[model samples]
Target: MNRILLQLAGLFSALSLSAFGGGKVVLPSMHQAAVGEYHWMTSQQFVDLFSISMAAPGPSMMVVTLVGLKACMPYGTVAAILGALVATFAMFVPSSVLVYFAGNWWDHWKESPWRHAVMDAIMPISTGLILAATWIISKTSIHTVPTAILGVIALLLMLFTKINPVLMMAAAGAISWVFLS
Candidate 1:
């Protein structure tokens, strides 16, 4: 239990620091660590957790807490709670501190040409990371033909339409419940 808790702390802390744009940017790495390296959960379980975290009101990075809970579940309830707390703290604190300091520095350099150049470079990098995360999640979630179709439709809607995403998500859920269930 101690070993697992420490591992969770280390993993989340590292991931939090590297989360350039947001939690979504580190999804691929999180998936790899939790599903591939640690075997804390299956790929499907990671995807399910990701969906839950996204649907929840708080930060999407709450997936780290879920992962820690799942990882420590075999130990017992107390351990699970501890794991969740440790992971959440480790995941949020360090990056938050960095952001605080970096934000101040960024403001200080508001008119610097290098700041603008760096921001421009980050845009493409962040986009690439987000695309990789999307690909990884889609690969795990879209196994069946109907699911694939639904995903494509959702993508198109997101790209081209002004429809509310929550509505689209609810509609997709209903469609899946009716047709795919």
Candidate 2:
């Protein structure tokens, strides 16, 4: 009981620190660990939770809370709730402090010669991580032809147009309901 909770705490806390761009950027590794290594949830369940987090009002990192609850489900709802809270706190707190201080330091160092070099060096890595996350999500969610088409269209729209993402998402939902369902 205590062991499981502690493990959940440790996993999310470590993941939080690695979230360079945002929570979404960490999804690929998080997915690998939660689904492949830990056996906390299925690939489908993970995608579903990710969708829920995306649709929710807050940051997509809320997926950690759902993951924690799902992982602790066998123990009991109380255990699950505790897992959710612990994971959420672990995911949010420490990295936030780092960001706060780092942001200040970055502004102070804005004129440093190595500042641009360091940021430039890390740009590719950050972009690669985000692309990896996209691949993982697309691989999991594109089980159907319509879905694949929809994703392509959404990507094209995102790339080419000035459309609001919310509207595009709603359009995709409507199209899916009309055609896929």
Candidate 3:
């Protein structure tokens, strides 16, 4: 139990620090660590947790709590809760501190030409990271034909239409419940 908590702390702290743009940017790494390296859960379980976290009100990074919970479930409920707390704290605190300091520094450099150049350079990297995350999630989630079609439709709607995403999600859920189930 202690070992699992330690691993959760280590993994989330590292991932939190490396999350460049946001939690989504580190989804691939998180998936790799939780599903591939640690054997905490399967890829499907990770995807399910991701979906749950995204659907929740807070930050999408809350998936770390689910990861930790699943990882320590074999130990007991108390252990699982502890794991969730540990992972969530580790995932938020270090990066938050870094962001606090960096934000201060960024504001201090507001007038610098180098700041603009840095921002420009970061744009592509952030976009690529987000794309990679999207690709990873798509690969894991879009296994069946119905899922594929739904994904494409959702992508098109998101890209080209002004439809509210919550409505889309609700529609998709209804469609899946009616047709896929």
Candidate 4:
């Protein structure tokens, strides 16, 4: 139990801190921790949980909390929540403090060549991580030809159509149950 809690906390903390844009950006890290590193969940399970988390009303950050709960119950949930909070704080506080003190200078530095170079360096790494995550999730999720077709259709729908994802997920799930199963 303690091990589970610690792992949950550590995983959440790592993703939370590493995330540059927001919770969506951390999905790869969360996937890695849960599916790849710890083997706490299968890739399909992780994808399903991600779907459920997105379908829920609150922020995507809640996905970590849900994953923790699924991993080890109440204690793991607490640790996950705390880990996210701590990790967010660790990233936020320093920037906030720096901004508070260096307001104009911070803005100026943001436009500097060095900053641009840093961003260029970071982009590829982030893209690679997201790609790896996509690969992993796809390998785990596309077990059958029908499922693969569903995934492709879902991707196309998400990319080209204006349909809500929750509805698509429901439709896909229903189709899977009725036809694939």
Which lDDT values do the candidates have, in the order given?
Answer: 0.90, 0.86, 0.88, 0.70
Summed backbone clashes in each candidate are 0, 0, 0, 0
Regions of candidate 2 where Cα sits further than 4 Å from its true position: 103-107
In order of appearance, the predictions have TM-scores of 0.93, 0.90, 0.92, 0.69
What are the per-residue Cα lDDT tens digits for candidate 3 across 65-152?
9999999999999989999999999999999899788897887688899987987987788899999989988888999999999999
Stronger candidate by TM-score (1 vs 3): 1
For model 2, how does the per-residue alpha-carbon lDDT over 1-181 read when each residue is reduced to its tens digit?
6876888888888988988767777888779888998899999999989887877777767999998888888899899999898889989997998979898788768888998888797788889999999899889899888888888898999999999877788788788889777
RMSD (Cα, Å) for all candidates, in order, is 1.5, 1.8, 1.6, 4.2
**Global CA lDDT of candidate 2, please?**
0.86
lDDT tens string, model 1, 1-181?
Answer: 8999889999999998988878889889989999999899999999999887877778777999899999999999998999999989999999999978888788768878898798898889889999999999998999999999999999899999998776787889899999988
Itemize residue pairs with steric clashes in candidate 3. none
- Positional deviation of residue 6's Cα in model 1 after best superposition, in angstroms: 1.0
In terms of lDDT, which candidate is strongest? 1
Model 1 residue 59 lDDT? 73
Between candidates 1 and 2, name the one with more favorable lDDT.
1
